[model samples]
Target: MEHLILTRDLLNTSLHQSRQIDFEIHKTAANVTRINHAFPSLEAAIRNMACKCATFGIRNHVDRALPTVSAVFKVSQVVNELGKLVSTHSASDLNLYLSLVKRFRQALTLLTNTCKLAIPWVEDVKLFLLDGTTDLGVGVDHDHPYQSNVCKTLHLLEELQGTEERSLLDQGILGVAFNKLEDEFRRLLIHNSSPLQVPSYLFSSGDEESDASDPLPPPPLPFPIVQNLRAIAVCFACDNQLDQCMSIYIKVRSTIVKASLQGLDLGYLDISLSEFDSVQEIEGYIDEWGRHLEFIVKHLLELEYTLCHQVFGQLDVWTDCFSKIALQSGIQGFIKFGNTVTKGKKEAIKLFKLLDMFAALNNLRQDFNRIFGGTPCSEIQTQTRDLIKKVVNEACEIFQDLSAQVELQRLTDPPPDGSIPKLVSFVTEYTNELLDNDYRPVLNQVIKIYSSWYDNNKFTKRLVSLEVHNIVKSLERNLVTWAKRYEDTGLSYIFMMNTSCYFSKHLTGTNLGDLMGESWIKRHQNHVEYYATLYLRESWGKISALLDNNDGDVKKRIRGFNEAFDQVYRKQSGWVLCDRGLRWETCQLILQVIIPVYKRHIQNYLALVESEVSPNKYVKYSAESLESMVTCMFQPKLDKYENSTKYTNLMGKIKNVVAGRFSPTTAAA
Candidate 1:
């Protein structure tokens, strides 16, 4: 079914070509009638010249040239007959019309060669036509007068300018022939075009497979089509219709080029920026935009440019032809999309996509200049360069704006379990992507040009590194502000510990880690230690200080210690340290400081502990037991309300058992 449809379409196109050719043939037939009328006058002039040659005793040479002159006139008559056949040809019988055109072209070629040969003698006739008499003296040997017949026929047409028999050979006969060639050129180009396969480099890592060193030339057109096209191009040149031929070639090839690009499913290139609701909405399109841009420039456009040289190099206008097609079909769409994205709202996520575009274009910088580099394609060159600059500037602004984005995240409440804040997590992951190998170089270029830290300053780290560091620093500063909202000084330190520890631990082995270095990790780790010390002092330090009271109220101090220990344990148990290693180390730090000191103070009250019938009230737990209790702090809280209620009820029961074991009511019972 598809084949039948395609055949119909081809038939329609051929019929159209035939009708156009038939119309031109009709115009040329009128010119042929004028040429036929001039033939009689031209033969009369040749006979008069033959008489003159006899008078000069050159009749033998003139007699020999007469047969050649007759052959030239016979070829002109054949051209006139073919013109009539072509004019009456049916559009449905296009093959016959084209065959007739081939014969007509052959006849024209023969006539043109004969004209060139007789041009010298025709100069005398041309002078005679100008003043209505021969300029050459009759006594002088009319050099090759028989050779001048073909030339005299053309000169006769010129001399009969005011007469009704004036020939329109240049504009009428050759115009029809060149028009046929033009249609054939368009037909061959359209039929031979094929959809390009997707190149690997578009999806793979940056130019790894399809390197610039391995240039891919345009695939060859069919051999028969190429020969026919070359023949047609030569004919156009011979007929002085090069401009007409080039115009048609550019128009047809440009349409095919644009259609090929559109076939890649890049319709978003034509979408307006206002159609997108958010800046991030264009991210997927931008990603595709980068891949397609690289593919088009490196493979598709490059092949078209090469193809132009292959097809049109004879006319020395291939560069101009290729430029018009490239700009019209491919490069302009890419440039428009790039410019639209640059004008989008500033966003950190958009920055990476913009960097992808920048990198794609930057990679093709040399290719662009090589392919579209001259006066004919100056608009393309200028537009692409401007788009690159806009992308860079927009990306830089968005990247630098990251610090402001970080500063604006001033949520008062941190995570409830003393875990890392969402803002901190977002910033870490965001910066990690920014420091990726693909994006880092473009970002570095952005920073080197736009970063204030890059000016006149000698720094060991790159400007991208410094900018990322500033973003990280901004996150750290925001964390401090968030940590202040936690009223429990101990939980406040835990929040800081959770954040800094997360930054140090999770970012290790990542691009951001490599940029921040070991020192950066260690510094954050030291912050965890510092926060741990402060936590131990603010929380367990006060609880351990209960044992340092030296008054004689031993039971009171023991009771006080038990209550304080229970209160702090129950409260801190619900808190969490997201990093397991940090959680363990923090728990150990509290135990090491408090357990031994409490144990030594308990030794002073051993007799009291032994005197009580039930000593578990004041001496709630042993030294080892206290260490176990403190070790369990900073674990995840209960998730279900039922479980939490059960745990609370169970703890109440345990406390009642310890309290009632030595009560007076229990002893009386």
Candidate 2:
């Protein structure tokens, strides 16, 4: 075009030079008829030359006009094709829909570039026309004649093809497309979402090394679904409908997240405090809550978070979407259950459940913080912390209450057979379990936070030790009170021995023992020994006195000794020493005193009375028989008391035999 303009300028300059030469020639005088004839010829020649130039100009205009008109026709055709494609395809065919979106975006970019070609200056337009090298540097005038013509052509093309409505049409299309995508997203989530059963490994001992070593990333959505959703998200972002995109994402996924948790079927999550009549009623729920909490934080919420990132990572809404989903999901359900458990009846039995929950939360604290670290997730994080605190505080209260209950237990009756009391067994067993490795640290944490036990963050064994010690001491005091309830002083001693023996045995090799220390064990053992000695003194003292050499009438002494031994044997045979070693020791203690004195009193002194009075009369039991009888003592039998009649009859038959053997007539014969 610049060359054409320059050539036209040269032609015009040549014509002007020719015209001036002709005019100068005419100025020189000549014959009038010759001049007129010459003028006519020159005029004809000038006219002819002018006509040729006009013809050339017409050809030049046609040359420029043909390409412009054809280019416009081609652009119109491309616009019609794009409009038809965009209008024909349904967003349900997300693949084709996405392709159309891409094509449309490209077209828009092309139109934008076309609009930018609004260069006003002829030189700039000529430079652009020559080689397309000129930038024109930010001073393009849209109102220029050429620019307006191009825009009018474009608008005309749009009007012809209904392309002007394409944006509004595509907006409606995108709206429906996103709506369909929203449904598809929801459907895919629900269909693919299985209740992420917390893996069994997570429920393991919660060792820090184990957990850190086996760090688990949240599981991913299916590959196809992720790709599909990602494409949709990018399209929405390109179209500047990201807010609508995110709204759909958050709304659909939040519902899905909550539904997935509900599918866990932890019915206990729904149980309210008012509905729970007892601690036991809520015990199972608390266990489920702990497990469900692990599932939610480590599995379900993690999965949701990862899904959001995968689908919306290209957009800015992933974090916000995940936070909304987590809040609506049952993360709150888990935390709320903890609150309920902590606020329920503050019974000692509930402490174990509370500790279970607290321990679970403590274990998940890392995961919880990492997953819920977003600014929008503060409520969940704060509620979770508050729940843990409440659990610890409640556990401490119940533990202290348990101690008080133990101290105040006023049951007066000892166990029937002088075995361990049920109260002692329960308290010791419970304390042992509470002081276990898994639970003890949590208990200590509770005590540290809620009580004035150790007064620092350091975990001192003494904290739990003091707790167990207090519990044991309370139990011991209760034992003392209960032991006094036995009518027989010997039975009272036996009961104390049984209880102390139980305490020592139970505390021998456990966390409770480690906390209470060997001193506690030794003290209980000593109590057992003291009680045993007291039992011996109370039970066998009179029998031993009867065998003492009083130098009084030997017959009287023999008779008194026999009767006292008989009375004691009948009475003590029904008693029970639960521990086998204690039972053996008790029987041995009785025999050590009995056998030596009996052998002496009867062997030496009874010989004098033997000739006058048949020895069988005073000493019906020989030393061998006496030892056997003492061994049989303290062996518990259900029918022993009922069978006392048989014992009395046997003693009567033995005495009748003695009388027969020592009758006076038989003695004379």
Which lDDT tens digits does candidate 2 get at residues 446-539? 7777655434565465767776788777777877887778788888888888777766775677666667779878998999889888887887
Cα lDDT, all candidates: 0.66, 0.62
* Candidate 1 lDDT tens digits, 522-631: 99989988998898899888878887868758778888888998898888777887666777788788888778877876776776678777755567789888877767
Best by TM-score: 1
The residue ranges of model 1 lying beyond 4 angstroms of the native Cα positions read 1-176, 199-220, 251-255, 271-278, 328-330, 404-417, 428-436, 448-461, 472-485, 503-523, 547-559, 591-632, 636-669
**Model 1 lDDT, residue 504, Cα:** 73
lDDT of 1: 0.66
RMSD of 1: 12.4
TM-score of each candidate structure, all chains considered together: 0.69, 0.66
Task: Name the weakest run of 10 consecutive residues (lDDT summed) in model 2.
Answer: 660-669
Residue 418 lDDT in model 1? 76
